[model samples]
Target: MNQQNVRNFSIIAHIDHGKSTLADKLILKTGALEQRVFKDQYLDNMDLERERGITIKAQTVRLPYRSQKGDAYTFNMIDTPGHVDFSYEVSRSLAACEGVLLLIDASQGIQAQTIANVNLAMAGNLTIIPVINKVDLPSADPDMVREQLEDILQIDSTEAILASAKQGIGVEEIMEAIVERIPPPEGDPDQPLKALLFDAWYDLYKGVMILVRVVDGHLKEGMTIQMMATGHTFEVEELGAFTPVPKRIDRLSAGEVGFVIAGIKKLDETKIGDTVTEFKNNCDKPLPGYKDVKPMVFSGLYPIDGDQYENLRDALKKLRLNDASFTYEPETSAALGFGFRCGFLGLLHMEIVRERLEREYNVDLLTTAPTVVFHLKPEHGDMVVIDNPSNLKKQDRTDTILEPYLRGTIIVPDEYVGVVMNLARDRRGIQLKMEYLTPKTVMLQYALPFSEIVFDFFDHLKSSTKGYASFDYEFLDFRASDLVKLDILFNGETVDALSMIVHRDKAYYRGRELVKKLKEQIPRQMFEVAIQASIGGKVIARESVKALRKNVLAKCYGGDITRKRKLLEKQKAGKKRMKQIGKVEIPQEAFLAVLRTDVK
Candidate 1:
């Protein structure tokens, strides 16, 4: 086979822009998998990926196709994560590819995330292949999309592929274009082995699977490869790319993208973006990759049933195998009981993980409101990272606490501009940049404290604009702001985990709303619970939920001794699940209600 004939590329797109579906069609058109073998996004092997309709991790597949000139060549198709949260993963994937198939949703034209991703791809110097996906949608305007790309992205749109991935239309042309347009890998195969670790994950059947792009190397079965990041080395037991169904053996040489499975047992050993070189003639210099990603959003995840804590831990570990962006630790909460101190790249990433944990792992959990880490400087000594509201204890000091802020951007119709400005002002948003996207559309930028947005601000933004506003935000480090530590008291005792820092002006409003939501979500319990939000010793907001008058061994259904004992056991279990929020042992739903606070 001619090595120069092969083309290695990845499909890049924003969320729900049909990147995965296009990969499925490419698999079908190339006859990579047997007829009917592929369902959708066959490259995304994780069940969570399928359920979420978003590619959470990067995956690669190999397909053999005949180009327009009637020549057979192999195309390595990599599907990358589409969200901003996994930008690190996406960048690493791009590093291994020579070209990218940029999928833009036709109706949406160009979005905030789409622009950001395209810029990253261009920065990587990959061959840009513009593709207008979902062309068959009623609202699709490919011409407008092309104009946007040409004008904003400064890329030629004459070669844009207008096709509907869901309908498998124009997919053959896409495969042919891959061979004709994208250049083949270039490197000296005889040189010391040097491959870029784009992504990695643990597989139960194959142990550790490391996906690499050979920059200047040749890898074969039985050869030893060293992971330079962690200084661990392993022998390559097998190497190949999936033909969308079964793994096929092929020598991975310079410029080609493929997977190498060494009998390694854990994901920790195969760090993403690490360099892999043959152990015998290992490359002297490590591969240059992006800086390690640090999660900005922090929250707590608790099992609905405390007994599932172990199961939750195992589920999280399994999830972390494929998701390097997630950071978590086991923690105990007075309000939420026992759960995890989870870290996320952003709010979207946090929501996606929570949804996946529920849908994929079948673990019902209660999550706290997402928060940005605050730098709390003690009066006497070092700075402490405060992620949990419960971790913010009342300490007597003249110390300074710096709160995280965010640079928020929103695009909305010009008609709702005033409403949006008013909303932002209420949330302590300081206007920054404003631009006109189109004659009727305007983009507004604001610098807002993270504390203000954590409490149903997104909902308020949407509701105020009647869902016409779309926004994105980036963390802007910590700054001194007018912040107050709002403590939640249940039964006159403070729940350390339930305390949070909020903007002084907005604290009372948020407190009242949160307690109200909690009152509605929390079930009646053994005793009345008073949910109080306080600053220092002053109560700012309060909500009182009536105690359960009808829960204690309500039914002794049978006279049988065994049946009566069973009823007692059930009652004990129920009582164990109830949490004392203030003076009330509230059910788990109330804790979750706080996370879904509806800003009125």
Candidate 2:
């Protein structure tokens, strides 16, 4: 295969903007899969992705196409996730491509993620082919979308291809645009082997399989390759590209995208952004790797049964091999026992990881409420980064606390701008800027605390705007805040898993709501169970679960009033003694009470 004939590109778009559908149509048009075997979202192989109707992991495929001029070409397409949570995936995918198909929803036009992804593509200096997708929809206005592409994104909308990915419209034009507009990957095949390891996953039979985009020279079986980052060497046993499925190939040349099986057992050795080169004749310097992804949301993942702790640990380790953005460290809680303090890009990322651990790894996990990283500076100590609220138990030790903030970009209809502003303000967001993208669409910028958006902020935004708003954000900076740790005590003992850091002004209300929710979830015990929410040593709210009444008084119903009084007193004493020694078992629901966003 000639390097000049190979075109490496990726499809990037906002959520529900037809990226996967476009990829499917392209694959089908290329005859990569037979009609009988083809499926919707063919690239999204995971059940979770199919169920959620969103792409989680970026998928790569090789399409063999012939241009109108009758020249055979190999198109390497990486389909990327559109959700803000999976933007890291998009970035890595972009690194593997020389160009990108920037798909914009025809009806929705330019969105927050559209702008974010366009910025990313521009940063990488990749050739972006503007694609107006879903043009066949009843509400679609391709002319309006074209204006948006030109006005907002500064892209030449005259060349923008209007297509319906679902209906297989304009598939040929998209393919032709790839060949005409997107440049062929530039690499020297004669040079020593140098490739970028963009992704990898663990296989039960073949060990770790890595996806790479060759930059210089060729990679083949029996070649000894060393990872530039880890300095680990392995002998490549097999190499192939996915024609929607793994098909073994003799070798991978420069300007190509494919997977390599190197008989590597451990995944950590194959870093996502590491450069791969020949061990004996390696390149002098590694390729510029990807930036390290920092997690936005943190939570505790504990096993339902304590004995499954090791299994959970093993699952996380294996899962991390596939998802490099997800991070975890050993942690323990007084109430939840041994667990891992896990970090995720967002709430959805956390949810997907939890679901994968349970469904794929068969580990039943109990996840704590999500929280963002906080910076705490104590009066007599250096600055510390705290993810768990229980670490803030010594409130007096901290002189000041700083919370992570985000520069949020939200695009909504003009009619919903007021409601969106109110929602942002309610979340402690400070308005940064507001502009009208068009007469009907409004774009808003705000600086919001990361902690404020981790839970139900997206849900609220969608509901408030009637699902008309699209949002994307990036970390701004940490700012000093009046934050306090809200602790929940069950039977007078603080439950570390239920503790959270919140704004001091809302602590009383949140505490009150938390205890009330807990009161409803906590079952009545033999002794009166006290559920209290407190800050430091001061209890702010309390709820009591009454002790289950016994038949001691029922048995003495016919007795004299004095005798009945004596029995009641004795029962009361017994109840007091039980309350002193009895342990209140907080149910799973009680532990999840902190996740209820409507506590107010």
TM-score of each: 0.87, 0.97
Give the clashing pairs for model 2: none
Candidate lDDT values, in order = 0.79, 0.91
Off by over 4 Å in 1: 44-47, 167-169, 303-314, 334-339, 355-364, 378-380, 395-398, 455-469, 549-584
For candidate 1, what is the lDDT? 0.79
lDDT string for model 2 (1-600, tens) is 988999999999999999998998999899999999998999999999999999999999999999999999999999999999999999999998999999988999999999999999999999999889998889999989988887899998898998999998888999999999899999899999899999989999999999999999999999999999999999999999999889999999999999999999986788889999999999879999889999989999999999999999888988998999989999988787899999999989999999999999999888888889999888887999998888875777448999999999999999998899888988899999999988999999999999888878888899888899999999999999999898888888988888999999989999999899989998899888888999987999999998899877776648579998888899899989988888787777876777784832
Tens-digit lDDT track for model 1 on 18-87?
8888888888777777665556667777676777677877778888888778888988888888777777
Model 1 vs. true fold: TM: 0.87
Kindly give the number of clashing pairs for every candidate. Answer: 6, 0
Error of 2 at 270 (Å): 2.0
